[model samples]
Target: MNALRAACLALALVFCCTPPAWGEGFALNEWSARGVALANGLVGRADDVSTLAYNAAGITRLPGTHVMGGLAFIAPSGSVETRRADGTRSTAAKPNTWTAPHAYISHQLNDTVWLGMGVFSRFGLGNSYSGNWPGRYNMYDVGVQTISFVPTLALKLNEMFSVSAGLDIMHGHMYLGTKIPTVAAGTFRRFDNDMQLEGDGWGVGAHLGLHMRLNEQWSVGLSYKSQVTMHLTGDVKFDWHGDNLARRQAHLPEARDCDAEATLQLPDSLALGVAFKPLDNLSFEAGATWTRWSTYNALNIYMKDYDAISNKEWRDGWNFNASVEYRPLDWWALRAGFFYETPVVNEDYADFIVPTNGRKTLSLGMGFTWNNWALDLAYAHVWVNSTDYGSTGASGIRNIGITGGRSKNVSADICMFSLSYAF
Candidate 1:
């Protein structure tokens, strides 16, 4: 069918013209206000319903039914610079705001068993640039979103330890837009043919957790999330401006919407934490997470008559964090934390989609408890290290090569709040 051929043409254009980095460098760790306030250091001290996300085994610490829900507001800013023989040009990303929401419920089944469920976003990204930006052919506007649902069961083993396991069902969606240059055909001098692709997919994975109460002064927790591979099927739409005669003469396919599919392999991660409590009112925790991002070495998109591939060659990454919490009164608690993350993208394969090296974050927050109701609030500032790109022979869509360039002034701010009730 003509539609099928059109689809194949669109998919072939996708990899031939741009780097397929739609879902990279957008993992989320801000599952709850308390978790963010503690810089995700709560794996060992996971005492609330949010434990379903950090360490489900920690739910053994709760006696009755509990529920918690919240949202995180995020704002990110940055710019990209391209260097050429003529001069240097810079383009700022358009302003954007994103929100991630989380919810969890846990119940104790008898004295040794606990059941819990949670829904939250684990990966996402949203960035946009002007249509005329130098890198428009690589990427002008893009958005990726993912949500995960987990149901877990925990068993308390004596008084010293607990273990838990869960099934992870994840759903992901992506949208991307780029400009196709008609100059390549030699018949049309325009550079405004727009191409847009949108798709959504689902994947299944698993997670495990272990919690230990060593004596009374120190506690330990460990968790692991398995990898998931998603098969995304979507439609690609092309908006062409040149007349049919000129397009035919240029060997350009007719503007049409067609079906396409791609496969993405999401990474797995391991986290460990240790908490110390010198007194009943104070606690300190340290944690680290390792992500196996090497699984994302390549991407492939397929259509009926065409297929394309992009190589990423990304490396593994890590996140280290420390946090402290103090309860001056039985009903009031204050928290502070810090974290540092290592880069995963190899500069040799870096592209405009993710133009940063690593990240550093600092956060502060407070919690209030009254009767059976609890409220938590947190704020965090993230600093992204500037990174150089294009120098390593990176190429844009249509084989437009970038010999040298860099990204600068990258940063983000986050605000989160959560409310919980026990019955």
Candidate 2:
């Protein structure tokens, strides 16, 4: 295959497990938001320039000198409650707040190629439970974050067709903070693990796009991004900080080789988008996206040659999205959309840390322009169904194990704001 084709294949594999079951990238960008009203309507069909996250070729569609930036706030409206076998009920620890930021610059290089650069996050989740949280025994607290950056290039093959590609530079860290209990002669000891898993790694990934202009009022766009693999190497230290201890104990998992080493699986995806303009002032868009979540079967935590635990228990399903845009006048536009997503964690491999499920959502947004500047506003509400599950292990007195799953109406809201400059 050619160099561009090779790059596409490699990058697609890296994104295999990119989306977070808990809460990752903001809902607007990863789920529906594309370029401007004209771009988001077609479902990102004009991948030439909807920020660096979509098709690099989309840069070709932007004005010769243009820049865009935005921020998003996500809030989850529900809580996870667990009941142990002993009839002891407690609420899952959760700090529901997700903050996301994004920026991109697109410029035309002559008439054949366009260049752009962008910075953003792919997946991230931060949940904290006080040391005295209810289900402190099994899961007390956790904080995880990940991000990525990219420089892209778009080439116009001719007036009818164009192609674009990009290289991604990614970095992030993962750490679990919690306390486990220790049992001694007729007494219970509470100690801290203080085991922090962190590392800075880098890898190469790519994206491809094809834009076609059919007649004067119709156009179509398609794009693909390869997955990436990262090797996270860091430090592991454990100590006991408890008073009146009969003896010291440690239940540490070895770090394969060197003090620590780990590999994370992202995932790949394909998007097909289309745009239409029946009138000079009106536009509409509809598109589809598919991700390879089946590849995330497990996560194996190990040390040198010893075995820890496999993440294969996590299962990710498919997702769908649609949107539209309208320009009533020279500087005003209106937009709206719908979303549906399948489950990520399978019935056999579900956890409280990563609570996910089948979900449906409704969203609305609008944009206003003033000479060299433009502003976009959007909001979305999601409804999720409870998940099916089996017991993982014994909780309290063996009789307090996790059981009896119930349907939950978990909900979420998103607020998006963006500023753009045309040069």
Candidate 3:
């Protein structure tokens, strides 16, 4: 590759591999205000445009043509404090708030068929620390984002059962910044130099869903989202700080156009849910989701001159969620939900890049409908379990020359709003 292309490739890879803000693992669940209010347990009660994301098969419950749009605001707060062997301490800065948006449209085709499409961010993360933070060697900052477009078709076999399938087209981007450690001249101590990389890529996947109405008041749903592997090509560059400890002169020439490619596999997921409606205006649902996080054991980067792999060793994890909806008036509804998720990363692999562990979330929402237009709003809070990364752990920066640390007070607040119109 040319010098310019190589430099871009290197930087892109660094960007693509940073930590993102979302669920316990890397999965993103804020597709719509309704979905967030229900903790994403809408598989069995997909009566609106949001069904295009949770369970396409539920589209059979909608009438005419429906369109919906949503936006989510996420604010993450926490601190990673490094406790050196001698008892000194240092802390990393918190990340800023971020926004994720989504849109969906669906049309009922005759009595037995429906067509729909959805566009949204399926996964993302971003975090940053002070330039001179103690954990700079491990990570300074990272940002990664992904978007997916899914066109779906739902087939109603009968009044009680339906099936749906969709084609997934996804795009992604990444940027990473960090300080590389270098030995000081005439001394054994190490100093830091800045490094940055960025890149973008595309991938394809599939979505499948099934919905079954067992009785007038009970329903069950199942859905699967396939994994997508993004192959990103980008350039890299590094600044040597103009220090020449070896020759008491200028540092080595800047490295540019270092061509590289990284293959990132987004996890596959399966969700099952049951919904109950005992009264005319009240409905409830309980659901579980399983994500194949183990597939992301490492990040493999291929460069023209060499190759590298960042070990992750993530394990599969499960999420349990429950939600309730009450509609006392034809134009108004209330919603609430709760969920718990297990951590995918162990202390062995935990670091400043992704300090998340197990967590629980609670959500509240309200809706208003008039004529063919509707508005929905929701708020959610996530409580994260704190963890300590001591020097004795086999994983983390301690094993790779960076000081060990602990992540505490890790949590996030989310707000979402959606508007829907029917024709």
Worst 10 residues of 2 by lDDT: 7-16
TM-score of 2: 0.82
lDDT of 3 at 237: 57
- RMSD (Cα, Å) for all candidates, in order, is 3.3, 7.9, 3.8
RMSD of 3: 3.8
lDDT of 2 by residue, 1-423 (tens): 132122221112111222342331211243223342232344344532344575566667676787777876767645555554556344544547776677778888798878888776666655555565543443444444556678888888887887878887777665544333433323444343433334456666777777787756787778787776766655443334333332332222211112445566666767677777788776666776676666666544334544433344444445566666677888887877775666655555444444456677677787788998877777777676665435443222122355645324456676767777888
C-alpha lDDT of all candidate models, in order:
0.80, 0.56, 0.79
**Among all candidates shown, the one with the greatest lDDT:** 1
Of the candidates shown, which would achieve the greatest TM-score relative to the real structure?
1
Q: What total of clashing residue pairs does each candidate reach? A: 2, 42, 28
Candidate 1: give the clashing pairs: 17-397, 17-398
Better of 1 and 3 by TM-score: 1
lDDT of 1 by residue, 131-211 (tens): 988888667888777889999999999798999999999998888787665443554555556888788889999989999
